[model samples]
Target: MKACLNRTIAAAGLAALLVSGTLPPASAADPGWHTSSSLIGTSKYGDDFKRYDYVNPNAPKGGTLNTTTAGTFDSFNPYIVQGNPAAGFAGFGGGLLYDTLMEQSVDEGSVSHPLVAEAYKYPDDFSSATYRLDPRAKWHDGKPITVEDVIWSFTVLKANSPLYNKYYANVTEAVATGEREVTFRFDQKGNRELPKIMGDLVVLPKHWWEGTDANGKKRDIGRPTQEPPLGSAAYKISSFKAGTEIVWERVPDYWGAQLPVKIGRENFDKRRFTYFLDDNAAWQAFGKGGFQDFRAESSAKRWATEYNFPAIQAGDVTKSEYPTTSGQPMQAYVMNTRRPLFADPRVRKAITMAFDFETMNRTLFYGSYTRTDSYFEGGELASSGIPQGKELEILEPFRDKLPPELFTQEFKLPVYDTPQAGRENLRAAVQMFKEAGWVNRGGRLANEKTGEQFRIEFLGSDPTDERVATPYIDSLRRLGIDATLRIIDESQYINRTRSFDFDMLALSSFAQSQSPGNEQRDFFSSKAADTPGSRNLAGINNPVVDALVDRVIFATDRDDLIAATHALDRVLLWNYYMVPQWHLGKVRAAYWNKFGIPEKQPGYIGVDIDSWWIDKDKEAALAAKYKGVN
Candidate 1:
């Protein structure tokens, strides 16, 4: 089936998008609607006008850009660390020193041209793949990028980084074929997912990193530095002032400076990232002009009201309008299928049917979100319009495994928003309880045998979560079910979810990679359920889902692969593994207006870093306009 999907896409018109420098013809617009150009050696993004080399001949570069995420960074080693602001910064910061062979476009709609490699070739069967590197690819220190570097990366990542284990577990062997070539062979056949996986794997250098192991064996190259390390990229870490600041200077002789993938993206020669433990302090810095620009999360009220502050009203600040679908990553209440209460598919379905997403959106999110019905949303991959005849055939055996009402529009679960839908869903909840042997006595549901009341705790973080969750708690109480909301700090929240120690909790799965592989197993396979910090929020372990995940990873072509993924999604939906939640219609973002962003808009599907560029003219104009300003 994946072959068909791939064939259809290949036949549709993406060939033009893949080719560099050819103006996208008007006749080629339909089927490649979601496809973006992947122009080689430059940032033009194929020949699409939307992203044609948008160079401002007069635009000067040199300014500071400030952004904020959820937390502070005490650790400087983002490569080996799992979760933290430093890791987030490492994604775009000075860490690109060990430049990767390739990178995904900011939006992830298209692939970036090779940075270190000239091209990568995959076997038609996908069991083996090879990379031909650009001999010119060199580290900042003038050492050439070679096959040994790629192998060194594999050895170090597999040995030390817990996060690296997620992407590297499938590899059976990685071998250096030549000075600038490397090949990887997988343990399993029919798995064409390695190429996509390699796109996200950051490479390390062999000359600097290949060292003796703890046991002193020459082949035992240890894990790469948990702190700042080196290789070749646009920026190199200069110094990190303990708890306050991290500074990186541009590599004046960056080997890939002219590489298409690095061209417009890393224009800034130097980047300085500051840290503030408190969000309010960060906001104050932006207002006081301590930073070049601000990229931080904000409340809608603050977005609409606070921007009118004197600093903003005077045009010292500006906001960019960026929108993304809600649950762009699916985060909501998930039931652990490995646990007995939810092991029964009927119970999972019942829980989903009882969720009121519309109310949650309206009340908690200020109607700024959309409910998600599938793991894939707003794309052809979503099952919303797929021909379900075949899927229904696959679902036949599990017919009795799920309740009858699930196939209908009435019982379809939506993303939570408000309290009304919660109340409305209680009727279905009561029915599910009765069927599950939870007999209601005088309006209180009690276990059929033990007479103990059915009570469960909803574990999560965020103080505002209670605004929407409290209403659901009320509804559960009304149905003779005891539900309570427990809010904790972020660390505790992470520990709880990582240990599989909670009854119910909220989580969102965000895949920067559109080509799904490891993430599928990470989320649904029994193997990953107990793996600390993996994303299997529901802790699901059905053989059917496991089979579907394997099929997806194995399929070489497009249609069969998508069919497998769709099948897996359908099964998960049928089982009600997650009470899917809202998706942001757009990326709700806040940024400072003083900086001049470049004209090369990432072809409409923009990413945070793609749209940023220093505007010297804007800064000059602002300086002329607000001389002696705060």
Candidate 2:
């Protein structure tokens, strides 16, 4: 799964700038300072650039945005894994409650502009990075944001959250170099991405968190709390009803409201997220207007057949697919290797062969998705055909350790076009299982040594996943395997998955960026596998994978990063750690026609809800239509 805090930035741009002789070579003694950063190429926006091209600076803002989430939340804090965090509390670009050091550009893959920090400087070697906080930056209480707060936030996050621990592992220390300046030092040099990623740090208020609450009890950063924390962002938590709902009110005098990055964003006066027990309930609420304003459709079955509502028929609602330039996430049924039953790669491969994605797509998905083939699908970094050149060189040393077929053949999932072909694949799967010391004895597949039945359970929190798992389970049973699907509550699911307590997850996704880096470690590294609450759900512990992850992280240029990622992807595919599912290239969404969207949408993130404004005339018309119907 993708880390909630993950954001992309460019590193190759610095190298290109040095090569072009546009700037003098920088070193520790003479660092170059800039207002923006990028990891793949030069930042599209320069020092004089105003707002992003995708936003409308003139758009008026005053309406409320009502959205719904499928699960309940118990805590306001999203930084720690102690409790389920409320939706919109925190995510990419600091969500609604907090502002990060920099704001990510939705249209660019690997670029970000200053938000809290006015300017930043880094050496040629990227050993350390320093940021000068904007003097105008302030918390809700009107106190200026300090370097001490930046240092404290980084120190506390890295020590408490496993996700942050793995992400900032390379960052050694944060020190106050000046009254408004803080520097983050790295453990090693030559990592161009480190300086850029530091821009993603969500700055927390040191004074408020450490101070006492209204009850006179000291607040703890590690514990879960319902009391809304202080924030520097455009919105603050105004009200909540435990697991039922949460509402955010935009700050009238938000300190950075006029900043370049915030000019045309956070357009809504209020943002409310209503919680439902499941997707079906949420869908019903969305159809009954006023309960929900926007819905991002995830189920193909529902999107294909269930949009005949009155609002949609009357043109009061708009349903459309928005194309995106973002990388296709790896959505799959993840098998936990830490479990004894899935310890062998051969057994995992046999199990994967039983899944008939072609049939599933035709019947259940309405042919809306494409079969995923790589960990980094829909991106140029995905490995295709056979390994050659740099990718081959990276894998040469591990030739004896890896599967030989991986080197000779292109990796592709088994396809079952006909019933006969399906049967043939099943037979092949049984034979492979037999070679791995499993056999069908008296019509039940059991281990030859232990005589234990090959039982597996697919766990899921969503009803939609259960629909897909039911068919897959039937296929597994045909092989004489005891397979079952278990649908649990959202809270229990989170607790169980974090502790690696499940045999298999019905759905686990690994979201990728155009410029992959440190986040790869949390997804595939051995250290992450051992860390509770980390994104490494499969528990991959291969040393070769660890080495390859480093290669991707420490890659010096864009080409080197792509080649390294290709090598890593090939190795991961050959391991059969998970059964690849399918993905859609476009985001399917339905929303009321009362909002006005910008002429251009962000290419990388698709729809930018923050850039949208309420159209008064349309809102009035929609209200009149609903009144007439009533």
Candidate 3:
């Protein structure tokens, strides 16, 4: 993220440099690192602020943080698409190995505290951004980081990483403007979030990547490798067995440890991630103390019935459920509109009706989820009732191209709690299918003109998901449509989904932040429909959707952004692009009692694992308590 620590020199403090709220000026268009809140405002934290209030500055640092996850990793590389990468790779842990240009504060959504950059700033128009580096930053091999590494990292990542290529599409140039400064010039202006998004870029070490390995084999960023790559973060890869586990050891003298943003974080001596292909196996391991740390339960049935395990009853494990304010993700069975069978919105709508969320929530999920009704579910931006005011003004031009119901109806999922309710919903679905050239003949659904029987297939990687998909498939069968679940491995699933090769698949898109921006393009824009690895799993290609996504990204203020996002959500729902799933208000977390954490957690994050450190006395007590109990 930086060639060196800017505050590492004689200035020694940010307050001395930004006493009047201005960073060193570079040019009119490209300002050097500066303290800021918005594109045109001051940051929430003053220049003299030491560390985040959410973290315990006096927290002790020692002991390992263990993680349990489902899946197998084939490579240690996180940038490439060649293999599955392991978890616990960044913040809270080192993500436990790489650092970004800026560190976003855990307590606030809109504010950011500088880390490697010392300070960063853009112009009034946000046409370009310039970063002034801290001079003390270094790579794991003891080599000083340089401006060349920043520029090279941007170039290679934009060229090879699909996500970055799309996310930074507007940024047209990246060149070293000075020894410790690099400028990223954008082709388009007025994108308020671009500068903030740029700070999220993960900087890779160009020197180690281009140099030869221990056996004289040159490293390639495009390929996957078992060899742990060099990093300058607080942790480095200590050891790993590919597909099994990866361990990172904390660096005692980490370069940015004393930086204002990192004062009380990364408190673990080591962090270990253990992977299991089976979810049940992973649960078993946690129960037997194979990995003694934390677990977040995803399945409602499992959480309701499986909490009475020995360790929990022994009072060694603590359970917590937090009511979150985070946006609920739009999780659903994405109907691939690129495929011919799903080309008609009517067919997709009919398939959505076949799902009985009420029954599943009651019988299968232990009534743990609430029905999701919007792309921006559980948030202020979610459209409700009918369109009006500024939002309606944004949608008026496309009124002819959208569903008439967008103006008259509130989008709602069908209720199928009773047999009669299910029948009524099915009847409505049948009418829509009839209009789309599908009809029931001799108890089998088929195209009325072509006499072709309808068949639907679900592509999945996790077998445990079958609990939900299989019942939906059975419901689809009752409607005379032949549907089946096709479970594949993680790699195959990723490749197929990326290429739009499957008809239907389960996907949970990332929840939107308070300010929704460019990422919406990758999720629903027409351009991303054809781009492989894009999040537009439904292959959305409507011109209207594209314009709405742009409007959301280019929104000028909070009101404008909310109105545009509401319009976008309304249009997507009325079209029935995918069946909406369910959401939970709280995150269920369980952890061993040997760790000490802050009393107040980050409001947005719910759980701040970074602020936790091992309690030495508790760890010793746990070892003595459970020594032969497993």
Candidate 4:
């Protein structure tokens, strides 16, 4: 719910429904209904608009899109927190198996178009919202998508997933209002985002979930399963090899294929995801012409030095950077405050100060990355130059509870131009730890009162993370802190992070959006800190942060929202919950030169793979060039 528009793929689902007699016309007493909604401003497209400008409406859809995910998957279900779900099942964006009530537009910020529901209406106060489902919307099994399915999905998702529970916490109830209409009533009014977020509801097939499986076992929605759940989306699981691979076959007769919103999207006839143990294995597979056809390279080191393979030299592959207008993701070394070792802000700040990002950028990243200073990095919402006016007014009341420097000083990470300066920063960090009841005893930093050694274990799932973690761990060792890096498998990593068992995460990313709303609660609220599997990985529980989160969520206008966000960013930074990392403003991707990209790339989403199609001519040329090579 962190602005559904931030999702990489809008779960494409909807059926060709009858145009006439779906529901009764809106009453004169009712507010004007809309086929689309926007959080920041008026929607870019009207009701009669065709496909998105970023997609090729005439794109031919009959090629396999092979991708890779670094990790094994135990369950096909992504809704539950109990297991590692296969990639593409579900994510920030809608999943390949399920479709949301509304599909987000990649080209726009916080704008959503109708999918399952044709139109939605809400009063001026926005206490509640009513959605009119498309009459022709049908499940893959040919059953009509009903109000029952909608209501059941909302109830079950909230009950099973902590993420969904926190996301829809304000929505009190979902009840059927008509044959194909369901209304979601909120606990309070004036939350304009509630109605819009309700559009993100991913409707499940109630009958399929409730029915017994082939083994005649009662299906449990709360449990993990590998049975490949029923789906209404454009693709379905065609085959899967336990933890190694999964393939989704495009539905030749997908009901929504002709829908305006989906006309040129989901172009691939087959989508296959092959799993690898680590980044090296995945990269090797790509070099060997394995299942991977495209990759969005995340490691700057690799992008700078590893793209000189024979394929690149032969012009069989292309690497490019796409500019994005989306809010930059705050990737950081997250310290779990639940642990006694990081309980003190001074201690956390001390730990953060050890991360020499300036040196890392130059040595490891090849100067390809920019240091991230703000939680809302690369965006207008980032607080800067000492808050004043509206932002200052929002933070003034909480001055007594916040760090005094927050109001006086412009918050920034210490920059070091020389090795001596970096060493001085480390000395200062040690002093901070000393002030927080830690003392150096025989070269080991220990708690003064308890005589406990400060031992920090940085948990990571990817082996590639060691390139960054190794130096930071060495830095901590120089300070006489017993720090180590634990690189575990993906499964163990997921399980450990869920229970807040890690001392600090080597790397964790929080994706932000232009409009920060209800999702902020799940990310920074005290309640979320206590909720296992919540996005509040740092265990942020400050009342000032809680209050600021609410202010951002309830801001009535765009200007007010930005001001509130600036205040929130300021407070979170001053708290030193995590070590700010770096980000690339543009997306760096390398792929075989067999796909045709759109003429106009969306500014907000940058590269939408769903809009790209296999160019038959290019693919044939590549096949001829690599004939017998593999």
Candidate 5:
């Protein structure tokens, strides 16, 4: 067989070369488990390293699981932005096919287990994490998974993937201490800092990727995606039909199958991800038993009214709200301040006043979503005060800093159901427009100085957005302003917004972290705005806001972090970088009524797939219950 540098090498060679009597006997220098400093001698656990309650510590495993997603992947190279879910699915599949240094838990919190390494050594606060690679570890084809592989993989991934933001940002260097030992140093001043960021990155093999570039010079692994590519995630590309489907077969006798994340999470015997262009089509196919797991992301009304299976009615399949105490940050309509027309605060406020959110909630969402007032939603690290409580105590100090109207409970933007309030807001909007030198002529607002029509484009992603945005645009048209709806593909939508090219785009900013520290920078920092591909669409550059974000990120105590976040929130609210929209409380997903989903899975959704299981008996019963074809 031809030796492929990028793919996993034979494990026999690895075991023979590194672990087969050639290396020195194991000594005290071998990597050993070290507890997180945050927990120290105490048994208390941080949110980062919470234990799962669902899976028995020693649960039996013998089931074939299938999951359906959207997209096709071209390469096993998980480094580049391929603009497809199949790429992610393929990468995950490859993770099982190959092993990185560490692995994340099902909950994606803390305690990375050893894959190639026997143990991980890090300070309590996670300032640095060092790995003593196991001499016995090998790639599927038998090449040793070594220090060179680790360094090469990190350098390549950090340079290519934009999503690799927090992965190795703190790392100062990765140095090989011995033949089977490597130490990762951090730029931060804290213990356990490295572990928090040490989840598996699917390290690539140096032997495969260490080559020359197009100029015939040695390929720079550190030059972010500049070279062809290299990675060590689970599944490698067997074949790819772009825009159609991607196939990735398992690497024969792959390494790292015993890793913690894999032992529990990525245990699918055979994994393949198929893509469909239309979401409804995909859902229907899943309904007909074309796929094992299907995600429903359409209208809630459709889920309640339209989607009906015999198993769901007979109580054979579980159909209940996935329990969630705290709502995740969600979809919102944000106005880009880069546009000259939206630069004026009054004009932006006027545009926001035109939206009839209550009407849309009643008609479209059926009052399922909460009207969001700030970036963070309830129960988040950033959420402070729904007019009272611990959040209120934090908000009290910022009351003087915030606008006076924002202090009152009723000081929120007018609800669309109240026509009188809506009209009142329109009247105020008219005044603001007049102040900005705009004249109302035949119900059309025109700039008095330039005689330019005050028009704005509301950009959205696909037909779903068009449905919700059209009504808002209609409201604006009625208010003597012309707001056109510009619908685009998901890829184009992301590309345009990332480059800060839109006038007013409908967006749903989901917060990935419990703390609002990083999200704030991505959404509001001038540096992020200036940098391409960052999420700061509004180009907001307030020094006060930047300082608050810095303080919030570094603050140890929860209370101090909340205070700093609230201060930042007030500034964001005042700036109106985005006109807040609704928070769709928990993830509104409907799976095929075949499997038995646990009520108390985990606090977070989307990433906790291991908590979801195949109830073989229930699935068999359901198949019998709904015997006939659709």
Candidate 6:
């Protein structure tokens, strides 16, 4: 039924039937549905396959699972420009309360299974992609999901949301060609990731937004709203106390319940989220078994020191660590290059070298953290040693724009792993600062011409972030840099960060992909530099970075992909745009013992409880034994 079905069929095995004149008319040639994305080669399971291997297909689904968060959510509209959506708002324990066209498989990399759409078709050149919606797909209110909904979703998202607009920049248009078929045309061709990204579109119901409210006012999809939105997913916002707590209940007549992809997932009958204003308060509430079922420990100090509560001792709370093999988090002291002070590469490098990671790890972190050196740390894609092979070839053209030392020398952060650590590093940092036209004057580093004292403010939201930043601030002060730390409220931080209003902030990019596609644009593209809310926090607008980002996105094969990514990683590292922070390979988590998890867990840590179900026996026994605890 898709616009590209005939072309896709001709490229497949069905071409022989048409060529031999054994097939009926072109209208009679029914196209087969796909189980995964086109570039993923083959689905691990055939068309007749059962549920995924990592889930418990027969697991019973009925129990209230509770979760805790530090910050209160102001609105339910996460898709818009304003407000943070509550966690677990979407059914099946993911994001927002809607279904994407296709869902990616957690067990396998780069694979996606149909969710709203039963099948999709696209040409080999990837000029366009078409999705055929499942006839069974329907919204929470029982309206059938149509091609109109898909088109409307694309239109509104691109217009209102900054993230969505930048993400879908290359996508030309989305058109509903048939009752069941919706096609997305791309501006650029031969990029295989286009089709998969099109599948990732968040389909919003058209009638709901255009409809009149109880007060006879039309709802604005562009603004944040407290009114709960309708979704086609497995769960709905059953009840809420606004910023305090949100509870989701399972939809009895969920359309996707019987689908192969839905089996063994979203096992909870009632999922709830309770929010606290502070991290410590949330931690204490979780420790005392006060309206929380699961807690992921963020502070290493707390994980090692403070998990000695009565619940933990009584085995009511189960603590565990899952080693992560996913893309490394690039948490960094991001230097704003738009500011004149950090525009110089030498000054940036000097600032990075001045930080004392070794001493901090010894005293503060209790030796649990690892000093991160690469943007793509702890992965094969990470750039190590010197670039060679195809990676070297990829960098050849951009050699003039890149750092000259990238070809001749290897990139290494100044090691403060020995004695005279503070003095030695500070000396080198002072020398670099002097080279950048700043000198120590009146016990402060001042600009040579302007006489402006070198000062930087570490902007943050959490009060506890000061502990992590204070040690670094002390080190910077030794270099005669007038360093200061300021903690603002959550809303202020979010608004300020979006507008690029800060001297420095510890930021993290949560983007991870086995294929590393177009999202790279939002992260490092020159176009995204001026745009607010982009992940390009350092305001990187170099042509060299832009070129490398394109190379990473349009890579032809696995070899070419790795080569380009490595090259990009090297250039980013040598540039010293970020003062490399620390990373942990695993997530430290603690949850109640009243649930049954899957026999096999996915490589990803968050999926450890994806197939978890309430064990009635354990629940009943715990209730009898520990009465009045929760």
Clashes of each: 35, 6, 15, 1, 32, 0
What's model 1's lDDT at 483? 82
The lDDT, on a scale of 0 to 1, for candidate 6 is 0.74
Worst 10 residues of 4 by lDDT: 13-22
Which 10-residue span in candidate 6 carries the lowest summed lDDT? Answer: 13-22
Backbone clashes in model 2, listed as residue pairs: 9-39, 10-38, 10-39, 10-40, 11-38, 11-39
Better of 3 and 4 by lDDT: 4
List model 1 lDDT by residue over 1-630, tens digit each: 000111010111011111111112231222221122331122344434232254333344455554432234555444442444342234321244666666555433434446666666665455666777887888776777778778877776666554456555688778987767788887775565564345445677666554554556453233223355555877777777654676667677878766655555565655666765444455666666645355534344345455665667766676665543211344466666666666666566566766666665555556665676777565544565433665555545655654454444333563334556555566677677778878788778887888988777887555545655676677567777778888775446655766677777644343322345655666677776767655676787777678777765665444554565566666667667887765553433455455556644433343245335667666566657654321
1-630 in candidate 5: lDDT tens per residue?
101101111111001100000001121123455422221112134323334555433433333444454323333354454432333332221343456565433332223345566656655454666677767677544778888888766666666654344335556677887787677777775422244344355666677556665677775433333222333444454555564654455444556544434444433334445665434555666665535354534466666675576545655434445534333443457777767787877787777777788888788777776677765455534434344454356446556655565455333565766778778877887887888788788888899988778898888654556777788888888767878988775557655765767888655453433333333455566665676555566666666566666655554444555565665665566656676767554444556554434445555343245445555675566567555311
Provide the TM-score for each candidate, comma-separated. Answer: 0.79, 0.94, 0.91, 0.94, 0.76, 0.91
Overall lDDT per candidate, in order of appearance: 0.55, 0.82, 0.73, 0.79, 0.53, 0.74
Measured by TM-score, how close is model 5 to the native structure?
A: 0.76
lDDT-superior candidate, 2 or 3: 2
Q: Which of 1 and 3 is the better model by lDDT?
A: 3
Positional deviation of residue 334's Cα in model 3 after best superposition, in angstroms: 1.2
Residue 236 C-alpha lDDT in model 1: 79
Error of 3 at 575 (Å): 2.2
Clashing residue pairs in candidate 6, if any? Answer: none
lDDT of 6 at 492: 76
Which model is ahead, 1 or 5, in terms of lDDT? 1
Assess candidate 1 and give its TM-score to the true structure: 0.79
Name model 2 segments beyond 4 Å from true.
1-30, 91-93, 627-630
Error of 4 at 432 (Å): 1.0
